[model samples]
Target: MPEQFGILTMGDAMITLNPATTGPLRFVANFERKVGGAELNFAIGCARLDLRSKWISRLGKDEFGRVIYNFAKGEGVDMTDVAYVEGHPTSLNIKEIREDGSGKTFYYRYHSPVLTMEPEDITEEMFKDIHIVHLTGVFMAIDRKNLDIVHRVLSIAKEKGILVSFDPNIRLKLWSIEDARAAYHDVFPYVDILLTGRDEIKSIIGTDDDKELADFAQRYSISQLVIKDGGEGSALYIDGQWVRKEAFSVTPVDTVGAGDGFDAGYLYSYLHEFEPAKRLEFANAVGALVTTVSGDNEGLPLLEEVLSFVNQEEVVER
Candidate 1:
C-alpha cells in the first residue's frame, strides 16, 4: 500500500578493523571488512525487516568499492542509484580496539569519491517509489557540494509527500562545533522525524534533560522526536504525547553501530504502525544485540529473531 515501505538512505561506506586479542595494544589485529555507515546501516536494518531500501552515494570504481557495492546488493538493498566515479577511491575507517573492549577510530575519508557527490546525481524521478528519505549529519561534513546534494534530495522528497528522517550522528572529528550547529539548524525545519542521542542533543542544542530536549524539538515542529540514551534507554515524543523505554541488559562486546541499529529498528516498527512504546523497546533490543557481535551489521538480528526475543521477554519492549 505504501510503495513497499521504501527507504532511501544517504551516506558513505567504509571498512573497519579490530584487535585480535583481549590483552594488550601491541597484539595482532583481527581485520574484517564490513560495510559501515550510519545511513547505510539503517537502510540494511530496514532491509532485514523486509523493507525495500535504497542507498544513495558515490563509490569509486575500485576493489573496495566493488566489495561495498556487492555487500549492499547481497543484503537486498537497491544499489541502482549508486554512482561509480572514475578517479576517486572509496573511504575507509580503521577501528583500533583496546584490551578492555574500548576502541578508537581513524578515518581516511577526506576527498573520497563519496564527498564528490553532486546534486545532479539524484533526479526527481528517484522519489517516485520512495516512502521515506533518511539523512545523517555526518554527510553534512563532507563538503558544500555534497551537502547541497543532500538538501536537494530532502527537498524533493518533502515535495513528493515522502517522509523525511534525520539522524544527527555527530562526529566532532569531521567539522567544527560551530559548523555542526549551523548545518543542523539549516536542515531542522525540513525534518519530519528527528532521531538523535541525548549526548548529541547536549552537544548540538546545549541541553541535557529529557523534557528540555523534547521541548526544543517541539519548538521546531518536528512530528516525532526520539532521544536515545545508551544503557538508560530512550524517550519518545509524538503529537504532544511522551513515553520512556528502558534498554535491554546485555554485555556489549562492541558498541560501534548500536545507535544506527536503534534508528533502523525504530523506523522499521514505526512504518508498520507499531505502538511507540513497543517501537522503543524493539529499537533498544536491536541496538543491544548488535553490540553482542564484532562488526556493525554482523550482529543485527532478523525480524523473526527480534520477534522471538520480544515474545520470550529475553528482551523487553517497555
Candidate 2:
C-alpha cells in the first residue's frame, strides 16, 4: 500500500456554542457546545479522508480545552504538538444561525491561548512528515505576531520541498479588510497553492477582472490558484489554463465550515494526482455536503461519502 500523505496546520481551536433556535440570540436560551477552528477543521477534514494530519497550537488547561483536544484526537488528527497553557483561556464563540443558513459568530475570547504560541515555536522538525503546510488568514489575524509564525512555517516547508496551501479566510470580526489584504500579500509569494474565495481575492487584489487575477497569480508565481465562489462553484488556474466547475446542489443547514471542507477535498485530490476537473468536482461535493449538516468539522464527509456523492450515487452520512 502507498504511504498516506501528511499535512500540518496551526491555529486556535474554540469551544463554539450553538443556539437551540435560529434568529436572535437575545431570545435563544439553550446552546450546544462544539469545537471549531479554521486550521483544526481543515486538519479534521483531511484526517476523515485518511490523510495523516498534524496540528500545532496552544489550548488552555481547562475543560473546554480538553474537549477540543480530545475531539480532534478522536477524529484521528495528530495532537502531539498542542500544549496546555497555564493562564491563557481557550477561545469561545456563540453562533447565531439565520433561517437562510447564514450566521454571525460572537467571540468571547479574552487572552487567547494561541497568543502564547511564538514564531520561534515553529521549526523545520515540525514539517518532517508533512506533504503540505496549510495556513489560514484567520490565525494570522488573531494576532499580528502569528504572521511571523506563518512565515516560519512557510520557510521551513519551502526548504523541505513540501507544498504550501493557503486560505485567505477573511474575517472582518477579527481584522479589517485592509489589514487582511496587506498581511496575505506578504505571504502570497511563498504560497504554492492558494485556495481562496473569489470575492476575497478580488477584495485583496482590488480587481475582479479574470485577466488581472491571472496576472496577480503570475506575479506571485503561484502554481495552483483556485477561486472558490459559494454556491456558484469554483474555478482553477494552472499551467496557464483555466478550469471551471459548477457547484453541487444542496440546501445548507449551516455554511460555516464549507470552505475548510472544500480545501481538504481539493488537497486530498491534488495529493492523489486527480485530474483538475475531478478535483474541482470532488471539492464542490465536499463543500455542498458540509452544508447539509451543522457544526464545524462534523459536516466534513469521509472519503467514501465524498466518492458516493461525486460519483452521482446516493449520498449517505456515516
Candidate 3:
C-alpha cells in the first residue's frame, strides 16, 4: 500500500544526557541514545495516529544511521524513501535534560547525509501515493541548496495537487532571522496550512498579535493558520474566523517534541475532515501527550489513546 502522507526532512539523531543535578552538559554523566529530528518526530506521531506516513531523507550508511532507521521503522513509519549514502554518517545532536524540565541542545549536523540532500534526491515515485507533503522551515535554513530543494518539492507537490502543510520550526543557530523571513516569502504561496508556535510566529514574522498573524496568513493565501500558544492554548484561523481552544495540562518529562506532536495531531484531524476547532483540540492533546515521556517521539499516542485522553477516560489495564 502507498503511504498517504509524506514528510520531507532531515534527521538529527540525539544522544541525550540526563541531568542528575540541573546544570551544564559537563556535569551530566549518564546518557540515553534516541532518534530525534523535527520531521522524523512528526512522522512518528502521524504513524501512531494510523496515518500511513512516510519519511523522506538521506540516511548515512553507518550504525548511527541504522539506529535512526530502525527506531523510526519500529515506530511504524515508512522508511522506504530514505537513501543510504556510504561515505557520510548521519547527523548527531547532543541534548541536555535538566531537572526543571528546561533543556539545551547542540547539533553536529554539518556535512551529514541529510544535510547534503540534492534536488534529485526527491522523485515522482516518492509522491505517487502521498496525499499531503509536510514540511518545516528548519530544512530551509540549512543552506541555499536545501532551500532550492524545498522549492522544487513544493512545485512537484503543487503539480500533483497534493496538500502542502508547513511548520516554521525555526532554528536560530541554522540561519539568521533575516534569512528565515526571506525563505518564508518564497515558500508561503505553496502552503495550504501553516502551523506555528506563537513565539516562532513572532520570530519569523516579527509578530505575535492575532490581527497581524491573520493578515500575514491572508496575504500568503494560506487557507488555514494554526497558532500554538504554549500553556495558554491554541487558536485556529480559517475563513477569516478565529477559533480558540485551550491546552491540555500535563507534567512534562521532556518537552522537546511537543510541537511536532501537535502537527501530527492536527494533520490526523485534517485527514479526517474534522472541524477547525476540533482539530485544534486534538492537536493540543497530542502535544500534551508527547511531553509525558522522555524521548522526542516516545509519547505520541495512537488514535484510541488520543480519543481516550480527549474524553478523560481512565485506563484499567487487564
lDDT of all the models against the reference?
0.82, 0.91, 0.81
Tens digit of per-residue lDDT, candidate 2, span 1-318: 978999998888999999999988998989999999999999999999899999999999999999999999999999999999989988899989788877788998779999998888887777887899999999999998888888888888888889999999998988999999899989999999999998888888887677888898999999999999988999999989899999988888778799999999999999999999889999999999999997787899999999998888987745
Sum up the clashes in candidate 2: 0
| Winning candidate number (TM-score) | 2
Q: Write candidate 1's Cα lDDT for 1-318 as tens digits.
A: 554688888888876555455544456556666678777788788888788989888888899889888988999999888878888888888766665656677888866888667788789877767878889988888675667887898789878989989998888898888898898998888898899998888899898776786788788888989988899999898878789998888888777778888888888888888899998998988888888886778777787777877676544332
Off by over 4 Å in 1: 1-3, 21-30, 313-318
Candidate 2 off by > 4 Å: 97-103
lDDT, model 2, position 199: 88
Q: How many clashes (backbone N, Cα, C below 3 Å) per candidate?
A: 0, 0, 0
Q: What tens-digit string does per-residue lDDT give for candidate 3 at 107-183?
A: 87777686667888788787877778989987777666788788889999999999899998888898888888888
lDDT of 1 at 65: 87
Candidate that scores best on lDDT: 2
In TM-score terms, candidate 3 sits at 0.92
Clashing pairs in 1: none
